[model samples]
Target chain A: MKKILIITFACLISIGSFAQGNVITKHFADYQQDQSFTKVNVSSKMFSLFTEIDGEDETEKAVLDAMSKLKGVKAVVSDSGTDGAKFYREALSRVQKDGSYEELMSIQDKEEEIMFMVRNDGDIIAELFMIIRGADDFVLMTLYGEIDLNQIAKISRILKISGLEEFGKLGGN
Target chain B: MSSRFLIYLFLISSFSGFAQTKLIKTLKEEDKIESSYHLYPSTLRMINLQNDPAFDELIRPVKKLSFSILKPDVYTSKDMHTAYQELLNEGYEEYIEVVNDSASMFVVGNESKSRTCILVNNDEEYYIADLEGMINVLKLGEVYESIANQDTSKIGLGTVFNYVMGENNEKRERAKRRKEREKNGEKEAKKESFQVTIGEEDNEKKDTTSEQVDSLNAIEEKKENE
Candidate 1:
């Protein structure tokens, strides 16, 4: 009976780890089908293809190198309607409750609120999550798999991905 | 019977390669959407007509291009969403989606070799482009910037469509110039008409010009006397 209890606890721990990796998908699954929300899911295969491109300059090369390490990117954006702030708050509360991600930076003003968080695996960052809420826009984006804080800014600048600019605050790690 | 079934399956699999093309064709035919198709050569020619080598380089990897415009009355935002879902079901992965108050766009691609479609729906109309080939998706923003920032005078609707589809004004102009040159049997004048005379050559040419003017005056004086 003790052995059986130990095995069940081990299985639960493993499942929890798996769920931690997919926190964004688990939390925002409803937005995937909602017509009002714009959903984006870029597979690892696309990032791998970026590695095959020969960068034309040093900055491009650095960006490509950083992108190559990324496993995938998922974003759920709601720019229409007035529920942006509501969605942002919901996502924030859920992420906080999950306790897998640590908040890195947050900014709140009269017009907008932006938050940046990351899930770390040892010394390397495994995931970077961002939630931005403006007057009528909300964006929740997560980039997972082998992230480098030092190169995140460069990647965001070159890619010009929406809501990624918030992660640029990480500077260099 | 088994061989026949296998042959039918093979035909079905082969048609999947042109899924985006087939979709555009069907949309145009069924909904009567205004659409235009340009093959590789015509697309290249259109890019070349821009006279910007950079634009040509930007579109180098595109094998074919097609554009369709659907009026908002005919294709509502709900209809656009349904079409987007249909595209996702067709094995294309959504790379990015941007939605703003005025417009929304979805960029999706199947594989590196397959077509990348950009569907932009706004309050006014729905614009779709079927681009077949391995276009670097990363550079799409750059392409949009270049095209958007282009001088409006240079990119009239007629120039992009009528010019590529039927008329070739540039070619006609070239032929007309050639015929004029052949009729006169004179080579086209060099771009720079003024000759450069350095140092001593400059002084000598000035002196010769004055001497020729004096001689012409002398000849006129002699003719007047006669």
Candidate 2:
């Protein structure tokens, strides 16, 4: 009993939670497996975007574009590509017009998965996950890197194709 | 305005109108075609794949969650070299192998990009990727593609690919046998290593069990000598 207790203690001391990449791997797999990964994450932001609480559209669009550019990313809408576009529009609106800057930075870090916005030291990055299946399957979409959401959204909007009503739904992850 | 200029403008406008009429005619004819013949191959494929077991398996979570991390099991350099050749053959001549274990990506169209996405990771349980949904067939067994397009059936490409992986009876049997052989080999290797370690430890402690009896016998002999 004493040997086991010591061994267990030693193991706990040696391994940190994040250090164990296997756990993270499992989480990614599990979240993706159930199709719930994208659903939960996308809906989490849908409320904020729908209400236009703040710079939601602007932030949303940037995240969408960044995800589209990412490798392993396919389509970026479930409701429709238009909904994804609308979400991007909301996301882009949130870009720093004028704020404490520091306050925005703080709120961003607390933001959970499916959406994140960060600006610091003149550098900026925004990423968000979208429900990317065709109104059925849900897959996570990650959009991030050093670029403004507004710019990406503008470019994306210009490229929008026709025949997508669900795509126009603004509520996006 | 000169009559010559007017005539030129009229001619150009008339030609444009004529061309527009022809485009409309073509579109109308396309619309007139029956709905059954109008379905895109990719769209049909998407419908067929909805009921496939393999597709469901891909979307489901693994119980133990093992993904074969795309690393070089044989030769590291050779694996990279093969990826490069494959990219080049695929018509994306650009290649890069920057960091170890990270296969560089390559883009064949639209942009000049090099990416390493076609990796077979065996251990990383979860693989979430967005792929163009059109490709539907995979062929294996024969070294070459079928010169004889014998069958009248128009099967989705994914079906043929799945078949090659385990569709045919012969292929399925061969795969099963191969897996069994590999499992047995691994078991034997483990047992051999375990035996060697245990044998060494046992040898070191061989005389300790009977040491007390031997010591007593030595004492008896000493008493006799006295």
Candidate 3:
């Protein structure tokens, strides 16, 4: 009985350690508990609806395909009461320590730091993370999918998603 | 003989000061042209409630709506100025005129119960909302606060007034929801669905309806995702 209890406890400790080290999961939990942020989680089915958009150009189609494969999307937008810069710095350091995400590009434009990070295996990008920190706005978006940086840029232009134009430029860099 | 005089006096009082209701007459005349568009009462009631609920109470008593936004190259500032003079001559009282850096909005209406709202722009665009009830012009203005981009403005207002009049993804989604609710024996959902016909033909009068719905969907989807 003592030996069995020891083995089960060891397994539980390893699992707990694994979950805590993931910055994305940790931030999602932290944001949900904090009232200052508006959080949204969209399922894969909802993401697939982007594919149904008619009259899309070739680039739009490619982006839609990548979007459709997304497992899920999560975002948190902080309100005025919270200090965005502090939270952004904290989150960035945690993600850096997590080590799976590698910084793809970073832009420091007047009173804001926008960064894009990705987790990839060879040419296939497994996940994409975007952290935007501004004077009044702080947004962290996590898209779990096989997304390419070049495709994200094309999607941004067609959909007119502001600040995402930088992703297209990152490919050339 | 006194009663006869009273009847004669009533007829004269009713007929004397009225300016012959020229606004509705002008709208009917303009509607006959190929370019102008009007939304009749039957169409106004069909806007999908899930899209914008503001139209529900606001457009209830609207008898008809006619609007036209001419291409910049086709109509000039001089023509719009001439039309403004014609509206005043026809007894349409000018209410509010808004001039911003982007564009200008002119609003004119009669003080009577049979209100005729004529909104003209310096860009040679036009908007006419012929209502059956007494509507506060200021309240009606609130409904159109989201409108921008001259060409889309007409379709956006039209979509608000008549969403089902357009080809929209919301129409299908609403229908599916209605069906699910019906299967589940939801009374309110059934009532709403029955009020507005499902699978109706898309109004071909304006090809811009779908484009307007697309713009609205794009904006709303972004908000929803964020």
Interface C-alpha root-mean-square deviation, candidates in order: 5.4, 19.4, 20.0
**What are the models' TM-scores?**
0.59, 0.25, 0.40
Error of 3 at A106 (Å): 0.4
Give TM-score, chain B, model 3: 0.43
Model 2: DockQ against the native? 0.02
Worst 10 residues of 1 chain B by lDDT: B7-16
Candidate 1 lDDT for residue B100: 48
By DockQ, the better pick of 2 and 3 is 2
The deviation in Å at residue A140 for candidate 1 is 2.3
Pairs with steric clashes in candidate 1: none
Query: What's model 2's lDDT at A73?
Result: 19
In candidate 3, the residue pairs with backbone N, CA or C atoms under 3 Å apart (3 or more residues apart, or in different chains) clash, namely none
Candidate 3 lDDT for residue B98: 33
DockQ metric for all predictions: 0.12, 0.02, 0.01
Instruction: By DockQ, rank the candidates, best first.
Output: 1, 2, 3
Candidate order by lDDT, decreasing, is 1, 3, 2
C-alpha positional error of residue A75 in candidate 3 after TM-score superposition, expressed in Å: 0.9
Residue-level lDDT of model 3, residues B1-226, one tens digit each, is 1222211111111101122246446534655211344555466556422334443544544455554334343445555566667767766555434332323444444444344444334323333333333221112222332222223324434345343223233544676788887787777778678666532433442446888898999999999999
lDDT string, candidate 2, B57-89, tens digits: 221221111111121223244443454455456
